[model samples]
Target: MDALLTVVVPVYAVEGFLETCLDSVRAGLTAEENAAVEIIAVDDASPDGCGALLDAYAARHGGLRVLHLSSNVGLGPARNAGLAEATGRYVWFVDSDDRLPPGSVRAVLQRLRSSVPDVLLVDHLREHPDGRLEQDASSPLLAGPATLDRLLGLQHTAWNRITRRGLLTEHGLRFPAGWYEDVPFSNPVLVAAGHVEVLNRVCYHYRIGRPGAITATRSERHFEAFAQYDELYQRLDRLGAPAAVRSRVFTLMINHLLVVAGNDSRMHPSCRRRFFRGIVGQYRRHRPAGHRVPAGPAGLKHRLVAANSYPLYSALRAAYRLAAARHRATERPPAVSPDLSATPRPVQTTSLR
Candidate 1:
């Protein structure tokens, strides 16, 4: 039997959550769908017995495979290792701290078998620490093939998308070994894909880990995001995704920098200063060069920051937050949406650009 899907779950030090994740996956699939799946759990040299857990899963499951990294490579490298080993037509990368909401692999594969999109973006459920379930609010950014406006202007995360295996590997695509590597690779995926599928189903359950996730900690890349922003902006203009693409990109850059400004001591104080100054410079460049101003909270946040210093900035920021909270008070993910419709997959595809 040919495997239609390869599910890559990077094993980090989530000893507390690993078993539940695996068991949830096991319960989600049936004999036939499970049989058609190849599960790869890359143990990223976790010291917390996660590698042994992967071994145990491999021992019991006929379809499970383990990729044990020699050392603690970051998220991007661990995923790259799994990508190198994947043999499925489509790839679904699930974080160790998260799990699918049953039959998701089969659903994703069923869609890929016919519609054949470069990637399928699914709605994700974000689980709060208190066990409240709210569907992720940012899954619908790409209306079709990603444009510069869409990639940069809209919201995105790595957790809620499925990539076609051949398209990914043929391009020799791999995650950059950086803290927020997904930003670049994901943007490129949409840029390079012919068409993308947007499913409104909440298939993946993402846990919200405040104060502990690497994203909360300031690092070298935390400051380097400005460089990445500049690079993407230049690349998008070169690609001609549209002027709208630049608008989105501007929004992302502003949002990222402001968040850095708000970050207290997580990043080096000097690094924050450097990042802020760079953003101020970037804003000046955009203003003179005539880039579209970013919209929503991102744009408002940046404008407020540009006009004020510390205590004033903080006070103004609170108003924006309250306004945002009101805007989101009534929005919710679609309860019933397009599932794996029986549409025939496309036989040919070209670059989105």
Candidate 2:
């Protein structure tokens, strides 16, 4: 039988969590659904025994397909490899370190079979190091008159969303081979899609604060997010997007700047001066004229960055860090893992941009 759904998992050095993630995937699908599902796990040259583990599971499962990369190609390329091999009607991207909630696969398959949408969006539950699982907060875009506006406003993570395989292939949309690649691809896909379904249910369980997770660590590559924003805006412009779309794109540009400049605490100290300079330049290049100034702490940071005031921006970032620390301190320590259904996922996504 033709597969109804294909789950693409890009595996790296996730030996500790790989088994749990796979187990969750296996349990999430019903026996019938399992027969109609294909799990494409691309082992990205993990130095650990993850490749072997995946092979062992593939040996036991009929629908499990494992692809091995000779060398590390990062997350984007690894996903690309899986995408190339996928043959299901719908495609869902899941991180190797994350898992799906019980019955999620069956639920997703039922939805797609009933009425296929160009894209389907679901919520996520985040497991924190402090042993708390929280449901992700809902975005206004999820409940709106579905339009390009809503899609642009949605988070850029590949998870928590499923797209019709044809939609992606027809548009020739693929992740870029670098950090923050999701931005350009995800934004354009949402805009290009004709129909989108937003389900408020929590389908994916995301783990946060994992030591060695790409997002938990900071690097100069964080700057790539700004480049992605530029590419997204350029693509929208080339596609002749309307004023409303352009306006939202401008807002995204500002948000990306703030995230890279003010939010990234792991950024190298030497890169701060250069990063701030790039932020100011991007702000000038993209800020929409006559746009109402954003209000709130974020608005303040935006203005500071736009002003190109190094001292003030630095101070504001320091204060933001302190506030975040104090907030964390108030939460319970890492005692026991919270039930996956307890609280909602934290707003933090792989794409902080």
Candidate 3:
């Protein structure tokens, strides 16, 4: 018999806080939910003692299981391993560094049972070390079955949701390993799911100050995103994505590339024109609809940025060649210590702040 839920957590060098993570997960679950929740902690062969710690947890806890990988397979593969081991009817992917507040597991389980949607989303609250809570209202709960096109331009952070196991398995959803993995991995899953449910209640407490987070260090990984979107587009095309959905996907990719390009003047000043040209060129190949997506500052910025970036593919390429390498040598998130940190870890607390 399948377990009710599989909570897959990919653990890295979080030994500094693994116990806290486990405590929180344990605390957040209801008695019944706890019985149903099978913790699959994928130890990515961290040089730290996280693997041993996971083993310890498994030794003490009947519901928790430890998976020790021979090599660090990165987030996507670690998660895939957990899924392969999951005997749960439902699956929720949670980061090991973060903690769930009280009742979160129960809430997610209840939503899964009542709604039975292909996916269920919970709002996440940003907690600063100072004990203040900033709500992530980016995605208020969305109701009913959502389509691929509708989910486009959607604010997605996969941690804040519980996905139906059948939906994922049926659609063959899996994350693409490496940087910017979420978009290619998540968007396709959301698209494939026929129905989705979202809750405004914040069930997740995201820990931002953790070391080596995606945005915590600066690296060439992001620049690779420009090419990643291109890959996503190619996959979508091969998959024979719907025309409307295809257009939305392209537009989304264009928007993401523009946002990141604008941030790095050196990279964009060099690559923008060529990159923009490539984008427009590829976009034209797709043959989008007569309805020009509403022309806004973003669209205008995309056009202007594209223009500024062009005609100097040589100079841009030259700059990017060095910049990515230089940036690659640097740490990710590029900056140490967030300029702003909020306080009071956010807790769903059953709809209470």
**Model number with the top TM-score:** 2
Model 2: lDDT of residue 189: 68
Q: Between prediction 2 and prediction 3, which has the larger lDDT?
A: 2
In model 1, what lDDT does residue 269 have? 64
RMSD of each: 5.2, 4.6, 7.8
Off by over 4 Å in 1: 139-155, 216-221, 230-241, 263-274, 281-289, 295-297, 304-312, 318-353
lDDT of 2 by residue, 1-353 (tens): 76888899999989988877777777855678788888899999999999999999888765689999999998989999999999898889899988887767776776677657777777676777754776454354555555566556766788867988898888777787778878877777677677777665567778988987757777888888778778877766755666776777777767766666654554667888788888888888877677655689867877877788888888877888899899898985443333433223222211111
**Residue-wise C-alpha lDDT for candidate 1, range 144-220, written one tens digit per residue:** 44443443333455666688887776666567675666666666566656777765456677777544566556566
Q: Can you list the residue pairs that collide in candidate 2?
A: 134-343, 134-344, 134-345, 135-343, 135-344, 135-345, 136-345
TM-score per candidate: 0.79, 0.87, 0.76
Q: Write the residue-wise lDDT of candidate 3 on 1-353 in tens digits.
A: 56788889999988877887777777845577687778899999988999888888888876788899999988878998998999888888888888777667777777677767776666566665554556544543233233345545555556866788887777667776786766665666556666666554556777764557765544546655655566666656655677777777767777666555444432435555555565565555543675355486556544544455454534544565688789878854322222222122222212100
Estimate every model's Cα lDDT from 0 to 1: 0.67, 0.76, 0.66
Give the candidate number with the greatest lDDT.
2
Q: Count the backbone clashes (under 3 Å) in each candidate.
A: 9, 7, 19
Ordered by TM-score, highest first, the candidates read 2, 1, 3
